[model samples]
Target: MIIARLRSIGKWIVQKQLAEVVVGLFVIVASLFIFPGADLGNLGLQMVGFLVLVVIRLYPGFSVVLPLFASGLWYTGMADHTLLSGVLAYIAIEFAVARGCIIIAVILAIEWLVFGYVVSRDFNPQVEDLPGVLFEFLCFGGAFIIGQLR
Candidate 1:
């Protein structure tokens, strides 16, 4: 029964939003490769969380909360430690305009600073990895633009 249910769900997702589902999965895999030091268990948990968000994303009315959830995940270090910030940014900017993109970037940056330093108490993680942070930002920015276009 469970297997059949899962299969049906998979079929529905493929039929309705195959590209999105694939991209979501791709983000998970890419994050694993991108952030080698990230905890596997946390990544698994986050993947499950992402799936839930994706489900909400596909829901007509609940789609409004996706960016909120994604940004929340980003701040809490559950958004793949910002290594896959591009994916979250992409999701947030999927249907946004120019002003929305700026808002997303500002909000994401603020959360990254607050949670990464104050909440997680991980001081200076990016201080020495400035280049990496910049690269990730570039990817996130590019993905945001591409998502908006698509």
Candidate 2:
């Protein structure tokens, strides 16, 4: 059953569910494109976003910059006709950046599983369970900078 598979995956997934994650990213990115006003191109943005976050995780210095770049890209694609749409675009980008951090974690976890299966390495680690609320920090901190309107 799909439910059984999900539980097994979750036991090892550590972060977000792999299937939900892929679907979530698709929904979010598709929304960005299909919502019309944003005009974001349809192709590789989601995968690129995932990789960008992975690189940022490994290199903390890029954490903010990568999100900022993604936000700028989505923002640039905006074709909204009013101030409300402008504000929404900014907030939406924030959501994208925040949610994006989690998606990258999902991809890494999946890759870890595949590589471990192939190489006979046990990739089990409680690194995920040991986590604090750093994502909250990333989201709020990113939001605050935008609040300053710079």
Candidate 3:
């Protein structure tokens, strides 16, 4: 029964053009650069999201929501005068770890904001289920990453 279901799912994915998975990989790479400090393992969640979207035929929404959420998170909790001005402040260092730190901080905030806005706007308010599901997913994922990294 499971094999039959898998076959059905495979057929569905092919019909929906799952061939675009490479583009998803490119987005992941770009996001890592733009949102530094998101290690590969963190990005793996994004990749899974992208693939699931492909399988379910909702890739666009996944793309829009993830980065926006991460960006929002960055701006809300991480960005600061210390982060923004660190580049100049750390001028003496051959490598500006402070600047890199601040930049990553900014990315995380921005990502969260984008996520909150997308879910709040796109997910139906009347039906709380979808939003609840996403919240749980984010919480679990975030906690797992923090715990695992520690």
Candidate 4:
């Protein structure tokens, strides 16, 4: 019975597209790596939330919702990569669902606004922040391209 269950789980993973799972994991890892000084407590919370989305995404037809929900969660949470993950999630959804560029554009706009206006409020406003901003921009551009190709 255990073997049977495992087989089914394996099948589910294949059907769900392993690329998505890997992308999700990459996002989580990237977030943690980029923000080494982030509060461990908050990072833990975001990791859990992202894991939840990854698990939910394994179900057929559920991929469509996972990205949007993950994005929403990140946007509302204190995670260091909230904006990055949110943008990545939306782009991933575009790749998974083939949603039009317009939707992607809107999501990008919202992310830019939030990252620019809301999320920026947390920073200390120092010249040292320049690196983080540049890192985020690079991540965003790289993620969007990767998502499109994935």
Candidate 5:
């Protein structure tokens, strides 16, 4: 019975084209091992974000609110230790674009910028930080373009 249930779940994932969501969830769990010193509090928040991402992927109607929730998580310093929050924001952005809601995408992008600024405010940010920051922006831009292409 359990095996049958697992197979049904697997079938549902394939039917829904939810491989990306599964991968995202895997990465979230992997981060716990990758970063041994990660705060449990932040991990909890990331888990919440991951679950929301899954929900949004399954039901795009939830897309509008995820960016706001992710922004709040970032603003409160609950998502600062990892890139999962950015992934959540980008996924929300992609969903908004898919639905032809450019306004939501723009709002998400602006919120992302605010999150970035808030997270980076404490640091002096030496020259070495430039590459990482640029890469981060590139990822955001790539997400937008990918959504447009789809």
Candidate 6:
């Protein structure tokens, strides 16, 4: 019975495209290792945001609101977890492409806005944050374009 349950769980993961979920969790773990001083509460919030992105895979129609919700959680609770946002953005854009909808534009706009807000919140923009911000935007755009091609 236990083996049967394990097999069923594996099937569910395959059907749900949950490899992204596994990668997200790994990113979280790696973040913990990289930032040993990270706050537990902030990491917890990041985990929640990651899980919400996974939910988006299950309910593609919720793509609109879920990304916003996850961004809010990440920005307000833990702006340091930028990798989580990258993963979230990739998954959202892929979902939009899979659904063959123009919502991809909306998702891209939302991700850009969230990224800007987070970067501005964490850095002094009037000084020298432009290049870094532009690079980050390019990274996001690359993820979106790759999603489209996929």
Each prediction's Cα lDDT score? 0.52, 0.39, 0.39, 0.50, 0.64, 0.58
Among residues 3 or more apart in sequence or in different chains, the pairs in candidate 2 whose N, CA or C atoms overlap within 3 Å are none
TM-score of model 3 (CA atoms): 0.28
Instruction: State in Å the error of residue 84, model 3.
Output: 22
For candidate 6, write residues 42-94 as lDDT tens digits.
57655655654565666655545644554565557544454444554555455
**Positional deviation of residue 143's Cα in model 5 after best superposition, in angstroms:** 1.0
Looking at model 6, how many pairs of residues clash? 0
Candidate 1 or 6, higher TM-score? 6
- How many collisions between residues are there in candidate 3? 26
Candidate 2 whole-model C-alpha lDDT, 0 to 1: 0.39
lDDT of 5 by residue, 40-122 (tens): 65676566556555665556555556555655665576666654666766765665565566776676677566555544354
- Candidate 4 clashing pairs, residues 3+ apart or interchain: none
**Can you give the lDDT of residue 2 in candidate 5?**
100
**Candidate 5's C-alpha lDDT?**
0.64
lDDT tens readout by residue for model 2, 23-62 = 4455555565555553333223343345443444355345
Winning candidate number (lDDT): 5
Better of 3 and 4 by lDDT: 4
So what's the TM-score on candidate 6?
0.62
Tens digit per residue, CA lDDT, model 4, 1-150: 999999889877655656555766777677667766666544554554454345444442443344344344445664444423554444344343322343543344344444544454553356666676676567566655644553
lDDT (Cα, 0-100) at 103 in candidate 2: 42
Q: List where candidate 6 sits over 4 angstroms from the true fold.
A: 1-15, 61-84, 101-105, 108-112, 115-127
Q: Model 3: residues >4 Å from true position, as ranges?
A: 1-19, 57-115, 118-150
Report how far off residue 105 is in candidate 1 (Å). Answer: 6.1
